[model samples]
Target: MAVEYHGFRVTVDAKADATDTQWLCRAVLEGVEAQSETAKLPCIELAIPKLKIDVLMALSMVEQTAKQAIDEWWHARQPEMA
Candidate 1:
């Protein structure tokens, strides 16, 4: 699952096909950092990690936060359309 927050899109690879954990972690870190940077939320990368448990928690938090942020952002832009 994935979620976009503040502009950052958080995604998970629950069953990565990487041959090694190191490679998987490296890919995940780079992917998240890239997403964060492209979203103009540089510091958001600091919230992501390679650890499984940490990733799960962060994913959940980001999902919830993203929902709220999107609701607020869009609501402010088009209150009548909401």
Candidate 2:
């Protein structure tokens, strides 16, 4: 994914691998070297659930995208499955 705002251009690469269990996936995100930002972010779990919900939602979206892509590829080769 690539995004440009103001004068800065950011590009990211993400990879997800399914675990032995189908419901969970391992995800990793890497930013282009030139655009990478390394910083310590705050986490306050006691006050709100926003952080956890946002993370899970993003992961769910990624999983959905992967599932759609794989289904398309599989169905194209086997029309009967459609």
Residue 33 miss distance in model 2 (angstroms): 35
Best by TM-score: 2
| Candidate 1 lDDT over residue span 1-82, tens digit each | 7544444454534332344232121112112344245432111222443444455565555455545554564467568978
Query: What is residue 57's positional error in candidate 1, in angstroms?
Result: 2.0
Per-residue lDDT, model 2, residue 17, is: 24
Query: What is the TM-score of each predicted model, taking all chains together?
Result: 0.36, 0.37
Top lDDT: which candidate number?
1
TM-score of 1: 0.36
Model 1 lDDT, residue 18, Cα: 48
lDDT, candidate 1, equals 0.41
Candidate 1 segments exceeding 4 Å error: 3-53
